[model samples]
Target: MKKCPNCSADVEEVFELCWNCNYSFSEQKVIEIKDYTIQEGNREVNCLRCDIPLIFSGRYDFHEGARLGAWGNLFELFVNSERFDLYMCPKCGKVEFFIPLNDSEYKKS
Candidate 1:
């Protein structure tokens, strides 16, 4: 166990930041990730690159801090950081990310 420098709270050695105070042990800060997955049922989605069926993975509501990552920068996370539906291709390892339809859209579908 390790003590946090800022809060003096006990933290596990495996983790760099203090879970209680969110203190950064390193120069980089930790980003918060929130999951907002909705059941889309068994929808058939295919990968464009490999032409293989995609598997429904999970969903997430990324915060502004996490939006600073590599792929996060590509999307307009700064302006619009909405919920995303994640899909993965088992063969080519391609990830398909898109915004899930809201309640109104779901009714239309």
Candidate 2:
């Protein structure tokens, strides 16, 4: 484990980037998450590689298939179990993940 120089946050050895401050170890930079929002009615996204429209898959929860045990329950407490909407390209099978602005906003009708 190493500490992020920028944020002094404890970073795991397996992870190259710091979760707290987004500090890159190799680049020696603090990368920030982009501020973007998905339009409520808009759905289609183009695939950069295949140039095909991305199809909306579904929401994924990290804790979905987690086993119920003492350590598993303890692990869940420290982890962020945010749901992300998955999009996939039908032709190339490339996947992309996006966080919805409102979790309970709309259905895919």
Candidate 3:
């Protein structure tokens, strides 16, 4: 473990940025985290590493392409129609995709 030079918070050696204060050890400065994500749903989710609210990118649908290649046909069955919601952290630029919860769960006001 190592201590952040800016915030004096203990940070794992593997991580470059301090989790508590977004300080970059290599850059020797505090990382600016101005963008915060606001999801349409009321479901509040935070980044595991940065501990900041994640921005809801959008919803995406996956399906087989019109033209199948040699290996494409092999995995064709695996690439069925699927919908997923995408989320990303503005601070750390970390991304996460999840199967969306029930629509009723996000009754936007």
Candidate 4:
């Protein structure tokens, strides 16, 4: 593992970018980052661990037999192409799932 010169975080040898601080090893500088978190009306989302705004990663349709965990999907009836909003923390790579807040098409399971 190589230590990041900017943040002093240990990065894996094969990676060119530092995941913790967004430092580019080949360029020898920190990269500029933009916040692309899609904000919903009166509904703000943030990472619980990193406290950073979560970036919107588009909606997804989970089909039947999708393995979310050993116990299975969160909404059992969501197999019918109902979409869920996906958000992720850029720094920590933590992902979060949310039901669309402003969408009227969202159905209750």
Candidate 5:
């Protein structure tokens, strides 16, 4: 359910942007939602000072669990079985990460 190329409103697929004019759909639709579960791989971390090549972005779960406590009435069933890959280094934000089954250079396309 994503249709807001720029004002065509009705966008809410965990929106990246576009709140009716804030369009930012650079086309990145890798959706496989049947209750949530997508895990791809490609890890080779290295960029803490200058070593490049850090890519491994895949692992998201939302199968009816994610409401956190405090007035929100906790509800974190099935939590996360370890799935995080979001590295960034836009020049200096230098960030590194690797957690794909224990980072043995994860490679599961």
Candidate 6:
């Protein structure tokens, strides 16, 4: 822990800016290592429209090919796939996504 120069509060060693005073520590090397072990697994979320628990489905990847036009290879951008949690509400006949495709469960299934 490092003491903030402006407010004298204890700031995290990895934090460059003091949380209390917002003092910028440009000279310091803040090493931020994110640990993914503690990340929570994907869980079911209720549908906003029907309040029904959503189901986890499979994942799909979408690749955008280069556009063949006058300016060749100008717009060769990659489009990310849309991961969706398939959910159906029998009460209201509503089908929607409970979670996005970037979620961990999307890759798992």
lDDT values for all models: 0.69, 0.76, 0.76, 0.78, 0.55, 0.56
Error of 3 at 42 (Å): 3.6
Top candidate (TM-score)? 2
User: What lDDT tens digits, residue by residue, belong to model 3 across residues 1-109?
Assistant: 9999888999999999999999988899998976444344444679999999998888876675553577776766565466668889999999888866664443222
TM values, all candidates:
0.42, 0.47, 0.43, 0.43, 0.22, 0.31
Please rank every candidate by TM-score, starting with the best: 2, 3, 4, 1, 6, 5
lDDT of 5 at 73: 46
Candidate 1 has a TM-score of: 0.42
The segments of candidate 3 whose C-alpha lies over 4 angstroms from its true place after superposition are 1-40, 64-79, 103-109
Candidate ranking under lDDT, highest first, comes to 4, 3, 2, 1, 6, 5
Per-residue lDDT for 81 in model 4?
A: 60
Per-residue CA lDDT of model 5 for 1-109, tens digit only, reads 7887556888889877766566667654333324223344544456677676655445543234456667334344334444456676655666654454554453332
Clashing pairs in 6: 83-101
Instruction: Find the 10 residues in a row with the least total lDDT in model 1.
Output: 100-109
- Model 2: how far residue 23 lies from native, Å: 37
lDDT of 3: 0.76
Which predicted model would earn the best lDDT?
A: 4
The alpha-carbon lDDT assigned to residue 62 of candidate 1 equals: 54
- Please write out the lDDT profile of model 4 over residues 20-58, one tens digit for every residue: 999999999999876544345224678999999888888
Better of 2 and 5 by TM-score: 2
